[model samples]
Target: MTSNDLGDFLRARRARLRPGDVGLASYGARRVAGLRREEVAVLAGMNSDYYARLEQGRERSPSPQILDSISSALRMDDEAREHLFRLAGTVPEGVRPRPRETVGSALRQLLDGYPNAPAFVLNPATDFLASNALADALFSPFESVDNLARMTFLDPAARSFFTRWERAAEAVVAALRHAAGLDAHYRNLHDLVGSLAGESEEFAALWSSHTVYGKTRDGKELLHPDVGPLSLTFQTFDVRGASGQQLVVYQAEPDSPSAQALALLGSLHATRHQGSATER
Candidate 1:
């Protein structure tokens, strides 16, 4: 499943379509299988023979305009279009992904003062920016490195760390895929998703299904080791326009065990560095 996968994936997706899905009607065809190459070519704005070559894997690359046409002919929604672009290696035009940045002292203090909630910042690539102690304790899977996408796909502990791992995993992948669509030159992101698709069967399964999504401002839950299941309301917002950085805030379920876990996490963050006493 390398870059060559682009041809096969596109071919498979095309073959699965029924005529009705693309606003086409059957005109009494005795066909071998699926939509005829000519039909798809007409809809996709490509030569019939050339479209056949693409489907047969004899031709791999297609121009952006052609791909967009094919996407439209296939009735692909925006999410589907983005996923198609990613597979076809067409980077979205004029997209410059902002570089990573260290959170400011003020932001760090804000996280520090969040006694009952967890807050962290993420770069465009979904890497951790600055996690407060509560965030650290709750999202401990991220402790090793800055990457959230990698952690979701590659980290061994993350599967167990996140409650509803499958859903969480999908969210991470979908968000990353959206970002990838916005910037095809997000080479690092492309590599990360590729690596994960190769390494994790779970990722492979979900990615192949062509699901796409963005981060929302609500409905998050994490199963903390010390605190059990902690549901939280979450929100994300732009923090720096120049950097394209986002501030993500997490709030525990009110009056739940998660609140206690958050308090414990704050204490842990506050004291663990000093080593007066410690508990995990």
Candidate 2:
């Protein structure tokens, strides 16, 4: 909740980023491991001292323009940039906002329509209980699991579900922090994250660095027991009736082997379930 947390995040991220990541030429014999403060300032088109001051919390409010520049310099995507604004105590500028965030009907219907691909609707806090049959099949690890933060941090099986467990875990932690900014009073979410942090060292390290980000349009490689490997792309879209809810749609690339694999999983699941039902 304090500015120190935010400052710590900025410093940590800067230190970890490589010069090559942002296209900064290494002229040889460099002192710092990553880009220096001055180098970042140059890229962001800001004074080094001013950037430092902001990082130190000496300066509080930064304009949208400056944030945009800094976000670009840091190679932040749209999801990451919006997350930055939220982390910096800036609310979405507009008309009236919602008192409580919830997903809408249309998006829910859309999720249901994805018969083969896995999909779900999530709020800012990344709670992903809402999903269709196919999504449930793909994300069976969290099916009927109301709390995503819990599944991510608490569940031992979660580590085996995702190919990039570390990256996924960090993203969830960062997302929770971002949500906390928008809804700091979310006691339930706060409690869940706290409990997970207590148990998992991986989560604890990520929590120390306050990285905030929204959902990015990316592919996830999931190894289904029946399907073997399913390559899926997740895309987020605005929910018309939901204020903070974003529709997360997942699909396999058309005509790809992964798509066939997904179909096989679906067919196998249906047959198995139906057979059990007949026996009962």
C-alpha lDDT score of every prediction, in listed order: 0.72, 0.72
User: What lDDT does model 1 reach?
Assistant: 0.72
lDDT of candidate 2 over 1-280, digit per residue (tens): 4445545656666776788888888776767567777778889999999889877977767888888888888777676677567656677544425423555666667777888777787766667747877766676655446667777777766777777878788777877776666666565566766777788888878877767765668778677665777778888875666666767788888889988988877787788779989999
* Model 1, span 152-222: residue lDDT tens: 77877787777677888888876775665556566666677777788989888876654566675867767
Off by over 4 Å in 2: 1-3, 17-53, 62-84, 90-106, 141-144, 177-189, 275-280
| Candidate 2 residue pairs in backbone clash | none
The candidate that wins on TM-score is 2
Question: In model 1, which runs have C-alpha deviations exceeding 4 angstroms?
Answer: 1-75, 82-97, 141-145, 268-280
